[model samples]
Target chain A: MTDTRNLGSQTSLPTKKLKFHKPKIGTAIFLTVWSIYVLIPFVIMFNIATMTPHEALQPFAFGWDEGIQFKAFSELFVDLCMGFTIFGAFLNTLMYSIPPVFIGITVGTMAAYAQSKLTWHGRDFTFGYLMFCWLMPDCVGMGAGYMWFDFLGWTGTPLPFMIPGMFCGVAQVFFLKSFMSTIPNDLLAAAKVDGLGDVMVFWKIVFPLTLPAYWCQIIFAFIGAYNNYLGPLIYLEDPATYSLQLALRFFSVFNKDNKPAVMAGNILAVIPLLIVYLCFQDFILKGINMGSGLKL
Target chain B: MEAENVEALEGVQAEIVERQRKRRKTVKIIKQDIIGWLMGGWPFIGAMIFGFIPSIIGYVLPFMELHTFDYSQMEFVGFKNFEWLLFNERSMFWLALKNSLYYTVSVPIYLGIALFVAVQLDKHIKGTGAFRVIMFLPTFVSSVAMSIFWQFMFDKTGGFNSILGLFGVAPIDFLDDELWFMPSVIFTGTWGACANSVLFQAALANVDISMKEAARIDGATERQTFWKITFPMISPTTFFQMLTSLVGALQVFTSLQLMARTDTGPNGAAVSVVLYMYNMAYQWTGPDYGLGMAGACGLMYQTVLVILTLIIFKTKKRWVHDND
Candidate 1:
């Protein structure tokens, strides 16, 4: 006991190890207000989701009215076709999201490899031009895409939405390029000396190495393609071809009276994203965390 | 063994040179280039055809008039569309333009506040991640979803009024009144904008912690550190947010479209540019496609955005810091 006390005294050194940083009153107040401000919509949505349609349509009250209305979920499923069948829209989202995810990852890997590995002429210039194109407002090309698709007589089809979404994004190229640049050039040289063909080196070696960046590109491509509104809004004239967002837009149409069920629909629409966020929480956050940092 | 290795190296070098020489031959180079082009070609071709070429067409279309749907019977109207838009008092162009400006100017303010909120969440406080996720929930919620939520929140008998009641303040008409329309739009807009704030937070986290420590040790206040050090470090992100925000502001379609049913203040109040364009093109039977095209004019907007970007880039020295 005496030896333990002596050892503890030696380590303590009669100095305070922890220093507290005082929290500012102004910031505390501001954060409280900001937190409430951010919580308002979520509270409203969460409350509305539980309220009966009549209660929802009724003047808002502070406390819970008639307990929870879990029937909204069943109602949404039942009236699915009334406001773009939630299941169909969900399927449509998957269909739209999958192809771009694959194409973005594949083509992004190839382009990034060419830019980083190949000493081909005009590589930097080409890459820079692509980045420039990425900066252009998506709306600038939107109307033109509509006109072009109209001329092609492919306006109402899913092709316009899916194909352009698959191949056209420059953000993926920029992302993958930054990732590929980090790979050591010595690896490529060694692989070449080992008699690996360019294609073999890429597929067998370089491709496997860039999986993290590939996942990043996949998540981005999936989200962007799935949430696409303006393209489908313009190019797709058929109701049947309506994307989930477009389907949701049908709910916002306040013809005779407001459809509060659409609020339920909106809440339900976000369910898929929540699932995605939960499943790929790490990749989504990591992707976003790294995306802006590596812009150079 | 050394000699054999040298000879092997020499043979490899010769083979490489011969291949390079063959690659230099015009025909062979052209063939290989075609293959290369094909491999890297789809995206470029798609971008040019779908994006570049079409924009060029769109740019020139306002200068010409399609008298009918016939390609052969087109007449060049020169600047008539521009004249119609600029000088025509009957058109809703000025009102829409004003509304568009309102939308554009509100973004920086919204985004500024958003950044501040983001900074607060990034302070490593308890429940910050949960708050970030909750705030970000609205972003994943579609605009249609946003409109629904806002409609409920801002309803006369809605949450806005209830909150107002708690403070003993009378309810105000949010959606119907012209004076309140843009503010309501901005309010709804800010609700869904928390995702962007989280993105800023993410960017801020990536900022070198050492710099913050250095600033702290130098006795800089929190505000000073934010403005002098943190702000400059995250300027790239700020610029990106500004650019995207501007683009989103200019294309303010859905919100305006939803809000259109509500009565405008006396003489045509709440119509935005895209709404006005839609109204002209589709609302009336004598569809003034030319007039609609004039109102849907993107070139001026594009030029302004491009110039703003260039200006920002040029003046980046004042704010942006890239630590080598």
Candidate 2:
């Protein structure tokens, strides 16, 4: 969001030789078609989300001719939110989401610091461990993970989702490690010379610098935690603890005939993600660039 | 003789002092290792429980007959569950295995589409930022939301067919029909191509313009210049993106699950291995084909993935440009 045109402009340097870099008519047409194709789903979602059931049933039809407006959303928040309101579900999701992301990133950054910035004997061995674990396919351990969580009495709670995340995946560590490599060794060495310890080095120096890199993963991990369906679906049995996804799933299951309300729920579920993205998109691009060792 | 004895004593004393200093250095290295492990390695506690242990169990559990979480009822089943997969007609494993394999391998087709778009946007454009955002908008939305959107669109009389009806064409059943299942998955994925294209964008930005400029001036066509100059630089990104996309697509759940009511699409066409296993783990009412059966299926799929991953990494030298 912060920058864009200068990015794509880099490769086409020869075009800069001219005063007018006339965008091809063909390109404009192609972009317009592509944009429409991409935007159609969003358009349909919004249009249908706001529509009355009758209006929604007619796919391309648009009319406010009958029934009260925003009725579907009202019913959604009122009659059919399954034990949790959309807001409650949102709160439940946040409760389930934030701790792990906060803990994970902190631990991940610290670990990444250890991997890339510090000197240690087992650094390369730990790197190998992270790579091996990162490549491990998930869900095969469904029985074991479930049994383990049950054994710990963590199945119904957020612990299953939260605690496991603190370790962070190889992807997060790898990206952060790559970004941290760009951190000059002498910079940390100089900090050490000034009597900064590992914790202090992380707090006062590395954290602020790595914020750009962390932002990318933070958004990804946060959205991932929020949008996680299977974990919540399996673990949380009580209606009181249903996340937005669970709430939506139940609502849609019983209320499939109420298409607009379901769509409204879907719309509400997506808003937080959209806000997170709109706010942090620049960081995502910048972070990816910096993380991947691009010219930052 | 007294002078010689004093010199020898000094030499021995120096050696002892040197040994102490070396021990101190080793101690310091060990201290750093402890600190590093505390910071980074502690998370492996959770990884061990949630990741490693389960993976180990994943391999071993397939050999057992403890269907439910009641580990007390465990029994050795050997290759019986694996045999059931091959022999049983009721087993959804066949179609599911076919679907997952095709879905995972078809990544290059969708990736090529994203790369094509990335290439288009890179050609000296201005004010294309809005388009970039629109393209990427779907990735930002939760997959559940995106899945719901696609679900409605692919509904028999939903948006896609409605649009088709306007063109004097027969309305197509994008969801219920098995033939359009993979196409629907690929089509739905195109909205999120913005996610895949971002890396390519970075790769293109990093491409050295001077090399391309040199080739262009020497009568190389745009396509020729791309192949010779721009492509070699971006192939690494392509390789990395492809690997991640394959892994991610293999675990396809929330999206495909949402698109169809049965959550597997028509005849399990959109059903991925993870979803298929999920049914066994929970939904499928079989004390017979419970979590143990799912484990066997999951173990098989994971082994294939691990093998595929190794093959890809081994063959990296073939495709990935070694500019570094």
DockQ of predictions, in order shown: 0.26, 0.37
lDDT tens string, model 1, B154-221? 77787788788778888876776777777877777766666678678877887777667655554556
Off by over 4 Å in 1: A1-20, A23-43, A62-64, A78-84, A138-142, A254-260, A294-296, B1-35, B67-74, B127-138, B166-170, B206-218, B262-270, B278-287, B290-296, B321-324
Query: How far does residue A176 in candidate 1 sit from its true spot (Å)?
Result: 1.2
Candidate 2, residue B195: the lDDT equals 60
The i-RMS of candidate 1 is 7.8
Cα lDDT of all candidates, in order? 0.66, 0.76
Deviating ranges (above 4 Å) for candidate 2: A1-23, A79-81, A294-296, B1-23, B167-172
lDDT tens string, model 2, B16-117?
999999999999888888888888785566666777776777778788886676778889889998888667887777788777777775588778877877
Docking class of 1: acceptable
Clashing pairs in 1: none
Report the Cα lDDT for residue B14, model 1.
100
TM-score between candidate 1 and the true structure: 0.84
Point to the candidate with the largest lDDT: 2
Per-model TM against the reference: 0.84, 0.90
